[model samples]
Target: MSDLLARHRAVMPNWLALYYDEPIEIVSGKGNRVVDASGKSYLDFFAGILTNMIGYDVPEVREAVERQLATGVVHTSTLYLMRGQIELAEKIARLSGIPDAKVFFTNSGTEANETALLLATYARRSDQVLAMRQSYHGRSFGAVGVTSNRAWKNSSLSPLNVHFLHGADRHLTPFRGMSDADYVAACVEDLRHVLSTVVGGDVATLIAEPIQGVGGFTMPPDGLFAAYREVLDAEGVLFISDEVQTGWGRTGSAFFGIQNHGVTPDMMTFAKGLGNGFAVGGVVARGDLMDGLHAVGLSTFGGNPVSMAAANATLDYVLDHDLQANAARTGALIVDGLREAAPRLPIVGDVRGKGLMFALDLVDPATGAPAPALAARFMEETRKAGLLAGKGGLYGNVLRMAPPLTLTVEEAAEGLGIIVDALETVNAEVTS
Candidate 1:
């Protein structure tokens, strides 16, 4: 482990964070569990940052990838027609919920957001964009520029004229004590104020995550985006849903997280789970905006046949098994379990999530302050107990939980019990 970590530090960026005091090197995964280099196994509650929507070692997805690999051509480069790519695009366009949607594929969520920004700016003939606070879009120059999460922003430079808004963080301040209806009203008013007074002119778009991922599964009330969308539409500003973490039924009740709001975004950017680990991502937008951008000579390796095959097969399994329903059922069971136990665990300051995506807001029990140290201890405890979780947030005190949508009820119970035990262990250690 030391040698591997030394090698990693030698080559990788210093800013990239790894979990645990001694990072576990995951060598292989199957179902919802992964094996470390030392042969210890962990039940993965984080799904590799929620990328593996289905699970690991899925036979259908693997066979599809193998079939595509056997085709003898790997780099079609979008210069030629490929049936898999075409079919996958059609499926995404239909699933996107944007009317007369057109699709463009990319290799990751960062590229997907970049494409969305380009399209929004080109269509509106403006560089101005609005993003959610306590949110993370991506790590690229433009994505980081639009992101409001300070921990992820390395530089102030950007290609777009960006503005930050009170998005999911309405749960944070100023609007905190208000009722749900009034909170939405307050945020809508905030949007109006920003557009009318702060932004220069003719804002291109507003991009947001239905639920903030790297910002620690933070989410707004049900109708927050719908309220914002009304104001944006009135001002000719397009709304883009960054579904990098919430897409493809991870949220349980809806096919896309945006659907939960009773509205549709003008454009949607997706990644993280579409290929179920095969590196596929994309944007779906209204035909007029997409055609207006032209986006000629877009990507060299985006939507390669191999990725499409994997994504198509992965999607098919999700649909065939009705994993959305499974996520809903199992997610509720786990969340209910957590809430029931939260009262006993004072370290759990807050328990929040939708479907499979959720967070345990760890806090100092004595002072009610964000406690990164306690969060770290809890994570280590969970690891020791054979569970792997994710962590992040503005204060780095939130523990993220997002198992595969394919999680079964029994698995959920096991993970929940492990979490309870970990919290108890950490609580005793801290109190002692």
Candidate 2:
């Protein structure tokens, strides 16, 4: 190990234990590839946890940043209106299909989610929020309260009235097994039961990730969002969709995750791909809810000029280049390839996701149980072999592949090949 690594290990706080230590020191990135200090190139499938929608070091994004620098105006308080912020807000509202929606910008996903939660709580004047089990909203205090992952909540045992809902339950699998009508009905019934029995009327907002990105990339059953909307509507609870990971065309969609289920959420939080790796996030809410919080809500760094300019450029590039469609097409190819390869590997349990976000569940060949250790080994081996993939799920058994939307088919294939090779190596070692 280098002296830098040794020093980091000795002095860094223990909270950084969540990430694995790699030998290589990545110095630069471009498109879907990253280069280490020694000029070794690696395919980056993780895309910084699905934040880099336009890939690394895109010329457009870089140019936008440079132009903002040239203007000598980077940061400004929301007390004064700025042209860049205004344009970016307008663009986001237009692209989100919610023209009248009001937006509150932030510097990160957690902040955006926190803003959404505060707005939701204020709007309904309720203390409780309902979130799904295995779902990850963010790591901040307010957002962490709603997250169901036990490991993430271990340190801060903050009090929160959060009810867990079973997501994409195979028993009620919509579009996977039953007819569309039956699937939709089952989902509706499930939501109704959760609302009346589990959450009741105490819930102020029901937050959900459209595709459950960190929760194993689990796609909710068809019409599930519509069902949840109905339940929330009946209870007069705000529906907040946390699109921190699944937004910004990463899921092959133009806007929020709720759109995939053909339902509109009362409030939406976006961050990951909003500025294409730049520090930017937003909380978009319905006109009524937004108006309710206008008096109390304030963020000093939100909607700054530089971040807004970057976001504007990102939105333009995404739309003009049809990156969402590209994600849809490339993602289909990757999923099909994985399906074709799954039969050859007995440990391959399941494959799920959409657009550029996908996951592969590793299992024990003999017992068909989740093999988290094997997944860890696969990540290590793949990283050694020049690919960067991530692990998700409560057990960390899901291999998460969320490459940038700009990733080409050839790059996707190369990344998948690395994964296949790593899986085979781990499986062989286990059998031996």
Candidate 3:
């Protein structure tokens, strides 16, 4: 181990942990592969929690950064305008197909979400913000207030008028007996009930991830959004779609994830894949909503020239290379492979995802309950076998396989093989 690694473990507080850190220290990356300090390579299926859509160190992105550096890095301030920032804003707006929408950039997903929450609340002059249960919206003060996961909240709890709707966990209740259409209708009704009972007129906005990424890759039944939109519109509540984990071609779609469901939101937050690993995030809002927040919020490094340049390059690459369509094609292949292998593995419970973002839920073979320990063991075993995977879900039983959009078909197959091997090992251990 490196001296720095030893120093880190000695000095760092283990209580502040987030992820289950692997022993290997990643030193470098190229395309879909990451190399550790010891020079061992691992096929990167994690993709920095689904942030690196374009893979690592793409020449075009590197060239763009180099060109920006040559011209001197542009700092973000309220005082000036940078060309790169303007270009990226325009490009994103055009691609989003929202002719009058405006963009406010941030350095990370949490900040972008914080901005959206602030704007939604301030504009509507209400304190209540409704979010779906089992959703993972970042972990900042305001973002954490809206996030549905209590486990992630830790001890930093505060008083906030945040309401929860039972959308993602609906499968566990009366929703399980309903058809898809009826389930969605019931979800929308629940949203309305939450607003009426808990939120009331104080409700300023309702935010949700179109596809619950960290909440076990839960897919909302069709017509749910349309129903929710109708209710929000009627009640004059702002609808904010947190697309931090699903935007920018991850869902095999263009722009925001809501587009796939055939409904638009009053505000949309994006990060993760936006800069393709270069640390960029932003909030796009409807024209009316945006016009109200023109001078209220600001960030120092929100839309700096270098970050904007990286975002522009990423957007261009996604479109010019047709990566969105590729995600659909490749994602289908991987999902089908998992389905075919599911029956052979007793630990496998469910497979659900869209595009490059997918999850395989592991369950106890006997009780059919979520098996978080088994999932963690599988992740460790997979990493040992040179495949990098992530664990998600409220129970932490969903093996999140959100690789880079640039992952080739062969690479997907190879990564899946490691997962299969890990499952076999886990099953054997349980049996023994």
Candidate 4:
């Protein structure tokens, strides 16, 4: 092992996962590329796990952070008024479509979701929560409780009682061959069954990601949540859209992934990409629900001026550049390119995602079983080709790609070509 690798192993916990057989430490980045400690450069297709929204070394964000630091008033706690915090909250509250919305800032997506769950349970007077299978929320105890993916969930010790419901993974579901209408109806019926038989009644809330990020960019049929929203409305259950990965126009089709489903959530939690790499996250909820936190509550570092400044600048950059439209256009090119190439590759099980987020699921050519080994080989080959990608899914066989929303058509083509080459190299090695 390298000296840095040895040092990292000694300092970090064993459960802390790192990518690749030999991990390279990233020293710096610009746009879609990052340079490692050894001066090697790689195209960053995963965009720091979809957190680097506008891309690396964004000038506006950098300047904003520098300006905040120059002020020398980074930490004033939530007790005192912070102009940056109030201004950022105003923007978020206005963007959040919920009527009479209010925003509560947090340090990360985990805290944001934790706060969302608290508001949900308190407002609805139920500790029970509904989540989707193959879903991942976060690593916190409260976040893990709702997480259904076994790979990431640490323990069963949780404050809230959680139930897992069927999320739309059409390829892996029994309804894969069914028509869209039929499949949605089936999932809705399953949800109804769970609500009635399992929970015995309405739960506090139903939380979901518009597109499953760590679950390999999994998507449900259109209007899936809208149907669920009808049930939630009837039962007076809150709908919490986990936009941690799907927010901020990354979905290309809409500003928020929930918009694709034709329903507005009662509450929405966001984190990734909002700060463009800064640790910024928050929840926007209806005024009544946000006010349900009866006792005194405040986050010490939730709305720090520095993070707020970074987020404000990042948001401004995203809007000024119209990166959302770019994401949609370039994402379409990448997906279409992969689909065209998929026919020749027997190991490719599926290519699915929205906007800039996508996944290429690998499987055994003969048996159609998830081919984790093949995915691993492809990942290594992609690294060799000067590309950085991510892998996820319950089986760990899905190659994930979520480049920055500002990705150009040429950059998308380059990444797609590298992926195609890597896939071919792995296929040849395995088939030989």
Best-first order by lDDT: 4, 1, 3, 2
**Which has the higher lDDT value, candidate number 1 or candidate number 4?**
4
Among all windows of 10 consecutive residues in model 2, the one with the lowest summed lDDT is 167-176
Per-residue accuracy of model 4 over 1-432 as CA lDDT, tens digit each: 499999999999999889999999999999889999889899899988999988899888999999999989878889999998888888888877889999999999999999999999998788999998888889999999999888998798999989887765677658678888888898899988888887855489999988988888888888999998998788898999999999989989998899999888999999989999999999999999999777999999998899999999998888888888988999999999899999999999999878899999999988889999999999899998999999998899999989988888998999999999999888777677
Give the whole-model CA lDDT for all candidates, comma-separated: 0.89, 0.79, 0.81, 0.90
lDDT of 1 by residue, 96-215 (tens): 878999998999999999999999999899999999888788999999998887888889999988888886765466877788899888888888999889888899999999988888
What is the TM-score of candidate 3?
0.95
Specify the highest-lDDT model's number. 4
lDDT of 2 at 95: 58
**Which structure is stronger by lDDT: 2 or 3?**
3
The CA lDDT at 35 in model 1 is 96
Model 2, position 211, has a per-residue lDDT of 81
Show the lowest summed lDDT stretch of 10 residues, model 3.
14-23
* Residue 318 of model 4, lDDT score: 84
Candidate 2: regions farther than 4 A off: 18-23, 155-159, 169-187, 198-202
